[model samples]
Target: MALFSGNQKNTAQNVYTNMRTYLAQKDGAVHVVLINSFSQLANQVFKCDEKYTTEIDYVLNCMQREGYEILDIKFNSIPNQGMTGNRTGFNTLITYR
Candidate 1:
């Protein structure tokens, strides 16, 4: 189970800023589950069935640019639908030095 706290916008900046705070509480590799539960980070911030892939991807990219290494990513792919049929993509782990 993952926990996300924030009512901020769905912008990468907002998400990234919040992520920094979340990461600050951790020491070493961190386990984060960016699934449907964190949909506010997506472009469709309301009345949409889109996953947080884009938003999460944005954060992931931010992490990479900051010299963070991706330890693992465990997500399910449903054909040509990334977040349409079954919204489930909770498979990513990040490690930073």
Candidate 2:
């Protein structure tokens, strides 16, 4: 809805920080699900519905920067044509080794 506002970035950073904390709490390697609600909002804002894809790319970069090994990322199937109610939602599953 709003152009990359400070609060938005902060929220993402906060989630990442929490993720880091969660990872630190674990004794061994971990598997995580990273949901990019920002990209979801972007889809709704721009009416493009491609936010999931873009967010996955961003997540890939983040993982690379953080040096986390990726197992897989779940993605939303494009809303079926002529139907909004049937929209399939998704989440990413990432594994760190």
Candidate 3:
């Protein structure tokens, strides 16, 4: 993946930026998913993946309870051995609505 030169921080920034724009500019339900692709920082001390996933869940659930629709749910898994570590060759897709 030579084409990739970014880190979790960059990915997070991009996600928030895009999401903010999407929510502000559009008036509809938003489908979100966080694949195992960013397993790079999955094991960090703060467990950022878990935190983000939790936030997504809270928001989605709240929205759903309020009569909004959530097409997808964020995941909560530790597919990576370590945050700064690297691994590949495995594809995990867990779906929920």
* Candidate topping TM-score: 2
66-92 per-residue lDDT for model 2 (tens digits) = 766666655544343223444445555
Output the lDDT of residue 48, model 3.
36
> Candidate 1's residue-wise lDDT over 1-97, tens digit each?
1133222225656758766765643356555534333333343335543335455667778777876666766654333224453333343444443
The lDDT leader among the candidates is 2
lDDT of each: 0.50, 0.52, 0.41
lDDT of 3 at 47: 36
TM-score of every candidate: 0.43, 0.47, 0.29
Better of 1 and 2 by lDDT: 2
Model 2 segments more than 4 A misplaced: 24-30, 34-59, 76-90
Pick out the ten consecutive residues of candidate 3 with the lowest summed lDDT: 87-96
Best of the two (1, 3) by lDDT: 1
Q: What's the candidate order when arranged by decreasing lDDT? A: 2, 1, 3
Q: Which residue pairs collide, candidate 2?
A: none
Which residue runs of candidate 3 sit more than 4 Å off their true CA positions? 1-20, 23-53, 65-67, 74-83, 86-97
